[model samples]
Target: MTGLLALAAFEQPMKRFAVLLGIGSTVCVVQGWTLAAMLFSLPFCVIWAYCGWLRTEPQLKWLNLMFAALYIYGLARHIWWTN
Candidate 1:
């Protein structure tokens, strides 16, 4: 689920690059490499989400929020609880 969430983030021109990184991050997350995933995907996800908000696209807005939440949860889980 987290992987899929991460996979949803992308933008044109950089879409292909972002997708590849997103997939790698998703794989890291799925493999219990939460730290690596967070370090890798957090920036891209933030940028993606912010870009979504900058546009008039309603779907991207909500979808990015959802993905952001999932990323946050994943980060928090690793930070405060998974320890």
Candidate 2:
């Protein structure tokens, strides 16, 4: 799964959005924008999770599912508490 993600970094289609979103997420994190970073990464995680499901890859599927859950939790917290 780790190797798959590494190779996806160089592969097309996946490369296009994944790499850009990854960089954007990193930039947001560096700028101390936690919510923005999660927003950027959420789609990436969801997409990979779906791909993992389609491919029947449990590790990738569960890992991304967990990440997506965390991001959702964080976003919900930010939204509910920031008001």
Candidate 3:
């Protein structure tokens, strides 16, 4: 019962996260950060591709880490570019 409820609670957030990442990836691509965009987009792509497999895949976890690191790097580049 509790476990079911926990699963239910997690489901929506994961769905929303997947959608958000998808949109973010699209934005990156549109902005012409091709390589950075691909790096930024990979986790969401994996999320879309694998769906329920995220829980079991260490590579997906590492992909998310790479996404985060790339996102931070992109932010720094943007700030540097604007200045």
* Per-model TM against the reference: 0.56, 0.78, 0.49
Per lDDT, the best of the predicted structures is 2
Error of 3 at 21 (Å): 3.3
The candidate 3 region of ten consecutive residues with least summed lDDT is 46-55
Q: What does candidate 3's lDDT look like per residue over 1-83, in tens digits?
A: 34434555465676678788778768878888665565556556545334334445567656666665676676677678889
Better of 1 and 3 by lDDT: 1
Alpha-carbon RMSD, each predicted model: 8.5, 6.3, 6.0
lDDT at 27, model 3: 89
* Residue pairs with backbone overlap in model 1: none
Q: What TM-score does model 2 achieve against the real structure?
A: 0.78
Q: Name the best candidate (by TM-score).
A: 2
Q: How high is the lDDT of residue 40 in model 2?
A: 93
Which is the winner by TM-score between candidate 1 and candidate 2?
2
Sort the predicted structures by TM-score, highest score first. 2, 1, 3
